[model samples]
Target: MFDWRWDFVAEIMPRLLWATGNTLMAAGIGYVIALVLGLFLALGQRGSNRVLTTILREGIEFIRSTPLILQIFFVFYVGPQFGLVLSPWVAGMIAIGLHYSCYLSEVYRGGIESVPRGQWEAATALNMTRWQTYKQVIIPQSLPFALAGMGNYLVGIFKDTPMLSVIGVYELVHTANAIGSENYRFLEPYTLVGFIFLAISLPTAALVRLFEGRVRSKMGMN
Candidate 1:
């Protein structure tokens, strides 16, 4: 039918963009949490006590082995049963951050270990404390190795933001669904949603590739 209202597209566009903004904010916050928490997980898994490291390793394994969707559900629904009520958006962000933190910890650990043993020796020879060694010597050198993985996960988080719609987060996909339900026209809304997702993800992937090239070049690995 040629009865589709063109003006409706104009009206929905603003709301869709607004929802997209929310999704972006959620992703940004979630990634920050993942970055900080991932560092802690990496540190915890590596430093000092054998029992602590074992627990941290097992926790990482458990999180990595489970489905993120189930984890989201558990954080959102199960927590409420215990008198800790987190909003869907909050729970979704927390779940995503926690899930990705485990993965990022491995990336960090690999990056750190990949650094030359001589570098560690040099830091020790300089009488640098552990904190100073990591702060000044290790982290700076290991960043390029970790950067590619971090960028990959940032794009990954953007892609996964759509899944937050299931928890009433009102992301792009959620906006599209609402539009479709109201208009009984699935084609336009769904197509637009797909296009928006592609617009975001494709550029992010391209940027990641660019970053990877730079990192490789800097390391002379290219």
Candidate 2:
């Protein structure tokens, strides 16, 4: 029987906890970038110019079509070849933000489209400019729809943070790998890593569900 090393676990616990802070920071920054950039992409898609709309649509489609891992590799490695020298954290956040922005842009598009056409017509009849109409009428009503989708991506980002380890971001999973390698005790480190993920994700998932319910209720959909 393989004996458990309690001493090793105790020693690694602090390191794992410390690394989790980095993970959370990365996730937080990545989410912020995704949110801001996503709104822009969505607005671009819905802009007045046909060329901008086409470009936005194609750009989003290309991002959604590609695997995120390759995107990370490309941004971290290939980008430097072209004179873009991004740190691992910056590259990871940018990659994640860009990839997820494509998805959230679709969410924003759906939200904007879901607003009643009559609202637009009413604003136009009132001599409201297009920007004014969108700002004062369309966006407020569509916010709830966007919120639900945004919440989903927040959860998605949390789950995908492990991928950042590949770029040398030193998140929780990366720390776990280091501990396991040093001690050659794969079982404890991997198992603890899974538990850590579950502890963080399950609660976050519940919050998303609660927020989704609130949004639906507020939108009169529930």
Q: By TM-score, how accurate is candidate 2?
A: 0.93
Report the CA-based lDDT of candidate 2 relative to the real structure: 0.87
Please, what's the RMSD in Å of model 2? 1.7
lDDT of each: 0.87, 0.87
- Candidate 2 C-alpha lDDT tens digits along 98-147: 99988888888899999989999999999999889989999888888788
The numbered model that scores best in TM-score is 2
Model 2, C-alpha of 189: deviation from truth (Å): 1.5
In candidate 1, the residue pairs with backbone N, CA or C atoms under 3 Å apart (3 or more residues apart, or in different chains) clash, namely none
Clashes of each: 0, 0
Question: Which residue runs does candidate 2 get wrong by more than 4 Å?
Answer: 1-3
Total clashes in model 2, counting residue pairs 3 or more apart in sequence or in different chains: 0
Total backbone collisions, model 1: 0
Cα-based RMSD of the predictions, in order? 2.0, 1.7
